[model samples]
Target chain A: MDDGISHNNNNNQILCPIKPIRCIVKLGGAAITCKNEIEKMNEESLEKVSSQLRQAMISGLSSVKICGMDWSKRPGNSEASPTVDDFSDQSLLDSDRFIVVHGAGSFGHFQASKSGVHKGGLNQPLVKAGFVATRISVTTLNLEIVRALAREGIPSIGMSPFSCGWLTCERNVASADVSMVAKAIDSGFVPVLHGDAVLDEAQDCTILSGDVIIRHLAAQLKPEYVVFLITVAAHDTTGGMVTKIWEAAMIAKLGIDVYIVKAATDDSLRALRGELKGNNVPEEWLGTVIRLLR
Target chain B: MDDGISHNNNNNQILCPIKPIRCIVKLGGAAITCKNEIEKMNEESLEKVSSQLRQAMISGLSSVKICGMDWSKRPGNSEASPTVDDFSDQSLLDSDRFIVVHGAGSFGHFQASKSGVHKGGLNQPLVKAGFVATRISVTTLNLEIVRALAREGIPSIGMSPFSCGWLTCERNVASADVSMVAKAIDSGFVPVLHGDAVLDEAQDCTILSGDVIIRHLAAQLKPEYVVFLITVAAHDTTGGMVTKIWEAAMIAKLGIDVYIVKAATDDSLRALRGELKGNNVPEEWLGTVIRLLR
Candidate 1:
């Protein structure tokens, strides 16, 4: 069951079978964690999102999930840096019924890139150390993320992808036993997960990306609304503040809509309204996503 | 696999096979979080524990594992209380090679007590609702625990025992696939787990105690050292503070020694030294635990 490479596995008995008008709000690491720097977080931005979630639950969109990652645009740091150890460990985002998945930024990329872990199938001693390093780094950040959410009164728990999900031979998520996450949501508790180094059936271990997790979760959880909040000035999308994803094929396939937004609170809240009451959201609340994956 | 329990089933290949020196640090809910209040955490106490771990790693014991649960005590609160929703999810504890399992305090006990989940084999619809409530309550506390540990620089991740470990018809931990936790420890990241409401093999869903989890982990992981950090005042051991546990029969059977401590940080650090480098710790740093189950 822990084998890593069997992508697109499904079980109707599990994976959010209820289809409750749930929403997944993704806060980009760059947006909240200051993409350019190492070991930094945007408290103000995170606080805003946190408050929005508190208010939204009151507004009736109680079944919601939030996702984010420790995404970064690093200029490279010397291992000698005093704070280098701190960069690898971070925490996650918040919301009611939050199911968070974060990317490994400064924490994971360095060791993974060094050991060439991204190339797949590591069998060497030192390379295995790299896998270990990557887990330490990303999970370190996961701790911080969970802590930040806790301070804001959002009781969030961290679940390592390697512990809960397996990667495929192609270095993609084959199967993630995310029923725990779903169960957490059903009980109204937030489940904070992050993209980390995972055990691969074919590759031994590999990186699982946050975007990939988001898509996979979107399909399985069947959240009626999805919002990707890219929280950095650097990741300004072409379609502007709100990019409505036009992945007709995906929407038709999964029966869910996605958006890349500069502002997730308003968009997700509106999307939730559109989902719960079937109300027509104002046009201004639309199109904040990068559009379809294709 | 997601079922609550299968019972005392052991698989050495997947479980802890080697007799590495590991420690189980149990942080009582009252120690770190104000058990009487809703959603309040003790930062100073948690910070002290975090630093002790950092120093412990610096002193040579690197293969350390930490386990704590969201244990709490609460006066009766009506469902009508707005804050009842906030206590379910909590945070975690500290350390590098950490595995945390917390008990449900005010968050879980209320619902589980009402649901009779502990009696095992729940079949009624209302009982099912009780299971759901327990999960929400406990997992909520898990979030806070993870967050607190993260704040203190522990790269902690959450795992729901309900999903990972199963209970027997008798409600004991049947089996828990904790390989991910071992892998996390191997990688130097702490795996934060909590007492969760789970679907059982015999019972539909039931509450799994942190103590049961600790015992199973000790047996499977085969840690040379184990400590039960009971932070609540309710559990005053007859032996007084710094009680050296002489569960000779169980120790002989399991080949592992455990201590029930009141002061987790110093006592655990001393215990780590005693296990790692064969240092004689002072006798005063013992006892700190309440009564243990015979």
Candidate 2:
């Protein structure tokens, strides 16, 4: 079937579709953290998701990356630090062919602010408490996720942005060892990365968003599709319309064809079948925006 | 923590309340033929039984054999057959140091009878259809048990009574290669055996009871206990009382203690814990009987 690759009858070189959509399923933090939203994660639902993914894999889909974000009560501010404790089943992020990155909303935001790190930009002094708490949170979440995946018959390893020696300044991250991620994927395990305040040369450290991590990943992998199962629908009919618009604009700037679809519950089985109807992101558009040199 | 074993500080030779019982649990042919029982098998119940047996093994108990009877119903005898099928999780069976022998109750009991094998004994005059059906039935059930055990993380291997050279004559199994059973137990795997007609030198060929195979096993092993978990309690209190009497008397004659305890539901939980308490031939009387052997 259509594997997003065109073959020339005359020659053997397979022509891959520009921006070949490798599926990156970004599970919004709210999807797993909200009590009501995550209530449907029973055995049957998990089995159904597993079956669907197995089918996708069997269909020659190269790989699938599922990422989750840490949720906090604080909202509408990118500067709010995220932590790993807010998420469950973090091990789902660990796969050789998959890359999982999480947000640090609960683990570091308040700690960083208390250390007076958030007041100044990346140039601000490094707050030891905030840094230690961030590391602890990431390590704890990563361990839990790895154990869970092992129980489910999948072996996974964890990686940290801090361990990679990236400079973190305020809410922005710079100069990450992105090649390690590529190496992890090549080795057949899903590498998990998440939003974190990283050490930066220009600025002391910056907060990175789960969204930005996805963009960086898409640029490197040139995946066939990047599916973001977000908590909010594509159109923010709710009063937070301005925030939605800004989020959409930022994602578009990444030059990746992005589908902004509402998250699906277990009851809505159709979504699992890839039969979602509300919105569509065309492959051609994503190809024009995200340019992959390799 | 109390593993049912007591140690005498003076002599270091382990002292156990329950002597190492090397008894064969001869599963009745009627039990395996029951459909309702097989469906009741689940992970929870299987775990309970397996854990109990694991406890027993940890207690330093040695050699428990589980045997199934091949009791294919005669056309008219279907109503009289037991309604429960084998419910033990093969995985649990694999964990314990045990052996399994099954009966062909539904395999060819009727056809063998029609071919005059049941009456005149297993001779060439018997119809091949019945013999083949019996073999197939036993093979199928054995394989199913093996597969089920594998799923429960238990490694199991299958051995057939017929293939192992169990010969019969005139409905009497006079000889068998019982060494294979010992070898399986010695190697730390549960040996599976079933009841069937076997070649006999004097009687030509004979139909054997699972109970009889177990008796032969007890004589060889001289275990501490002999426990049977049949579909119906040992000896229908009414008509088949003779079978019970003969079993007890023969066991007593062998100079070994015999405990005829009724099993509930073939659920390993009840069987392993010895909780089905309608009747119990206690150790005191059993010891006395063994003394009579001298």
Provide DockQ values for all models, in the order shown: 0.05, 0.01
Tens digits of per-residue lDDT for model 2, B90-183: 2223234554454544443443444443443322322222333343344444544443333332333455554444555444554454443443
lDDT of 1 at A67: 20
Model 1 lDDT per residue over B1-294, tens place: 332222232312354522243565555555555556444556576666655654554343344332221111112422231121232232222233545666664456655665566665434433444454455556566656665554334555565665453344456666566665675565445566666666565655666666566666766676655555556475422222332234322432575555555544566666544442233345576553322243
Identify the runs in model 1 with alpha carbons over 4 angstroms from their true place.
Answer: A1-5, A8-21, A60-98, A104-157, A165-168, A232-252, A264-268, A275-294, B1-175, B182-210, B219-294
Task: Put down candidate 1 lDDT per residue, A1-294, tens digits, no spaces.
Answer: 222224453322255634463666555665556545444556676666665654554343334332221111112522221122231232221234546666554456655665655665444433444554566556566666655554343545556666664454566566666666675565444566776777665666677766666766776676666666654353432232332233222432565556555544566555433342233445576544332333
Model 2 residue A108 CA deviation (Å) reads 52
Docking class of 2: incorrect
